[model samples]
Target chain A: MLQKKVLPRLDESLLTHLPPFSRLERRQIRTILDQATSRRYDQGVAIFDEGAQADRFYMLLDGYVRVVRITPTGEQVTSLHIPAGQLLGIAKAIGRDSYPATALTATESIVLSWPTRLWETFVREYDGFATETYKTLGHRVGEMNTRIVELATQQVEQRVANALLRLINQTGRKVEGGIEIDFPITRQDLSELTATTLHTVSRLLSGWEKRGLVESKRKRIKVTNPHALVVLSQG
Target chain B: MLQKKVLPRLDESLLTHLPPFSRLERRQIRTILDQATSRRYDQGVAIFDEGAQADRFYMLLDGYVRVVRITPTGEQVTSLHIPAGQLLGIAKAIGRDSYPATALTATESIVLSWPTRLWETFVREYDGFATETYKTLGHRVGEMNTRIVELATQQVEQRVANALLRLINQTGRKVEGGIEIDFPITRQDLSELTATTLHTVSRLLSGWEKRGLVESKRKRIKVTNPHALVVLSQG
Candidate 1:
């Protein structure tokens, strides 16, 4: 069960920095926020499930999300990891009435959501909404295309390396050693991300750890040598 | 060498049925056509190359286009096939100044293009333009997601089967024996699409031919038994 917390007037400043709201006036931003309700979710909570009715759409205000898909045989694949200040569950943007994939929280997160009925109104009335939304969609499509090419042409090792590089680039935090993927991601997650087996992922990670390429412990991974991983990914 | 053909006038009916133009008024449609130049591309002609300047965007009025991507190692992969009545070279929509992939003509094609500068105007002025366009991008993303899942979970035979089914669904034409893929797709192309070796693709197709599931001859293929393919794809 999930609980929605009543928002006591979302501040317009909260959205001014976001790309989709950057061009809108304060009044416009206020109007947009007025229609939204905010909620807090714990890490590992599912925000939505695949094939469920897309009655609402959401924007992540804090933390990370894992976009997951289940194959026909019921195998789970982690399709994407989305950072904060991004929209999710926009099935209307994709011309579907049902959610296409499941969105799970990779970290404890805060989110604001609006009824799906207001989607078209927002697109039409909001100044930068459509352009920014489409731009985001385009970026996702480009990423998917890159992943497709990787799957088709790259080896398993290269695929895994590229996946790590992508995660670090998207949500890496600088630590003492290097850049740490700023969320809890397990070896099974990496295997799903790279389309490789868990044993293969374990073997490769162990080898890379020995070579001082990465450090993994307790479901967390940090890249100690990103340049080496880049080189490995290029092959 | 490429040649641009001047149009005396573009018929409004030519676009009335297209999704992007369907919601525009007559004068609005005329304004759009006025900004566009029509061109005829011969088979195998490259409409746009990856990483090249995206100065213009186009819509395929007739025939087909193949979206190709070259890997870092200079290997060609057929990423997608676009049928007529669809948009291509939409780099601007993706926030890209350069095309992300090369679009090659699968057959002699008629295309209408406008300067990239007009993309924003179209979205702003034309009703349903942004929505329809994003919907199309969403559909592509969905397709790419499916492909990624197939690559991750399916065997070589299953991947090949899904690829054929996708092609036939997009541009298949009913023929005497069954439905023929309307484009000239070689086994090498199938190999690229499915991320398998040419030898494996040939072997699988031959085995399927023996089983009366498909017919391949002279750079063309026909699905003789789609039901069997659905079964094969499920596994």
Candidate 2:
């Protein structure tokens, strides 16, 4: 069965990283992409809201967005930040008809949204696309498991540190002095993102600033000592 | 898009519950049944451990099993105790090569463990299999979301009531006096399942026993005043 190798030649780099889309048959994906439409979202715009009917799949072209779940008490908990080149609104595209969470534009962004039925076409005609999509689903399941563990076991301090490290690792840019977080995120926003109270977050930031691990001014945060931040992640 | 109708039948009664498979699709699933190899476990048997390489998925054939996770401090937590007909060890079957949590036998039981690769093959080769599998995945995602909400907001006592309610919903048996829990589970196990200490669990159980809301002795528990239990859940 392995030798049959009916699947198309895969891009080696993608196979080892990201979803298993590396194995996709190129011609099939090209056809689907030809039918997709792109649009732009302004900063602070609602890309979609919780309980909204899910009917389209979106792939980001530029900028970033936050996927958030609003608690019953009206508190918003940020689950993930989606950046350019990543897919959003997958539940809509994957056959479900309701938005799982609200998507808020973190910056002005370009996105490609395709009709949900287009996925059916891919699954029926393009084995490679379906295979890759399933692989993406698998990756999401693993990620959720990790989140569940963290939510269940990790202390608030560790969760906050992990959130900071994740933001820096994914979107930090090096400047003349140190690495800075790209987004104009506030401490209250960071508190919601980490599922902790703002008071604790404020105290932690103050502590970090005193120790010279990070610098905070206005709406910006800069990481002066990545190694020190890692040590703080000790659970 | 509404005319596209991904699920063609859309029957009120069936979709409201569970839909029947296409005849050919049922046959394919039956073949998975043919390949299924059953194993027996006596009570208290540890079926798998968290962080173990995920290899196989299990379908309970008889009796019951409990899903467990151990904290960093070596405290055991029981996530769920489920009976026959429900799937177990599914984390590995979808994509993970390793199991996420430990499973223990709640009673003398039979389970069918299948190679995950083979399950994937069945999902691909069989028509409508992918559709059904995706539904299962969606259902699990919904269940996880519910767990997340509970962990985030619910008190420990509320959590225990909810846990018992869930277990009763899944596997309880009707008797002359009340609903039998249908599994031999101790208060310690209940504590683990609810993410609290055993002493707290014992205290709650004792309180319930005094109120005649439940009957408990050693490893047995029966819900007598379900309405009262619901009040406890609310309070």
Candidate 3:
């Protein structure tokens, strides 16, 4: 069973800066918050699983979530890494009755969720809700299209480089040596992200480490030379 | 030049059955039709090109369109085949200023288009316009995700089989021998769609032809045994 902790009441100010709530008045934001329930999840917790009935939608308030898809052969593919202040498990927005992918917390995170039944009311009554939600969905579609093209045209090495670059762009933090991915991501995760085998990922990372292009140790990856990776990805 | 020929005023009946217009009342539909311009595109005509200013969005009223993307190395990839009664060039909805891909007519087609400036008005005013439009975008995203998984996990032959199956399901018509793709699709197009070389596609199709799986001649392909292809795709 998944572990969760119900949080205290949410404040409207907590949501005022979020894209989905940014356009609403304070009263409207309060109304939205009144309908939401906040909870905290421990690291590595699966918030929802693919093919499970989607009864609620969430907005991450604190940490990162990995959107995962399991193939027919039981191979796990890490499709996306979602950050704080964004919505997740928006099955209703997509007109799906069940979650399309599993959401797993990469760090201890806090999220606010609303029952799926209120999705239509929120879309119709809340100003800018539907527009912002659709915008987010459109952005996701664009990213998926780009990944499809990359898989269809680019070489494996290029794809791996692009995947790292994308990760750093989304969740990078400046460290002493270089920019480090802010979460504990394994080589196996990299392989899953790039659609390659762990052996290939290990080999490539070892080579990159020797060349000083990146540094990897203990489930952590830091890009020492992002420009080099960018150039490699372009090819 | 795009060979422009502006036709007479559009009748509201032309849009009643389309998803974007289905929930709209007759007068509201009339208002929408008043703002749209209908034009006929010849086969192979480019409706929009990638990176061009997205001044307008279109609804395909008749025939089919091929969504194309050219990689950095200038290799053209056919990402999708869009059939009639669907919206295209929806850059505004995606928060984009330019078209992401080129839309090319696969057959002589008719399209109704409106200025991009009116997108926000339509979304906010129409009862179900945003809901339906986003639903379509969500469906496309789902399709893109499926293609991504197929590219990442499936073998070359399986990918080819799945692509053929998708096309047949979308635009196939019953013929004496089997079900034929409703458009003239060349081997080159199949190669691009499946992310393989044309020679490989030719060899595979030839092998399948010998196995009584499919028939290909003069840029037309018919599935003689979809069940066999389905089984191959599963593996």
Q: Which candidate is the best by DockQ?
A: 1
Error of 1 at B95 (Å): 3.2
Residue-level lDDT of model 3, residues B4-48, one tens digit each, is 336566677899988888988999998888888888889988999
**Would candidate 2 be rated incorrect, acceptable, medium or high by CAPRI criteria?**
incorrect
Could you tell which candidate, 1 or 2, scores higher by lDDT?
Answer: 1
lDDT of 2 by residue, B1-235 (tens): 1122223322232212222134344445556555656667789987778778766777676799887777666767565566676567766335556776789999998776676767667556766545655665666665555555566556888878988887787888887788878888888788767767789999988998999989987888899988888888865
Worst 10 residues of 1 chain A by lDDT: A1-10
In the range A1-235, model 3's lDDT, one tens digit per residue, is 3333354656778999988888889999988888888888899889899989999999999999988888989988777889999999998887687888899999999888888999989888887787788788767777877888889999889999999999999999999989999999888888888999999999999998999999999789999999999998998
DockQ (0 to 1) for model 1: 0.66
Pairs with steric clashes in candidate 2: A54-A97, B53-B98, B54-B97, B54-B98, B54-B99
Candidate 1: fraction of native contacts reproduced: 0.72
**Chain B TM per candidate, please?**
0.96, 0.82, 0.95
Off by over 4 Å in 3: A1-5, B1-9
Q: What is the lDDT of residue B146 in candidate 1?
A: 86
lDDT of 1 at A48: 95
Which candidate tops lDDT?
1
Give each candidate's fraction of reference contacts reproduced.
0.72, 0.09, 0.60
Rank candidates by lDDT, best first.
Answer: 1, 3, 2
Q: Which regions of candidate 1 are displaced past 4 Å? A: A6-9, B1-8, B25-27
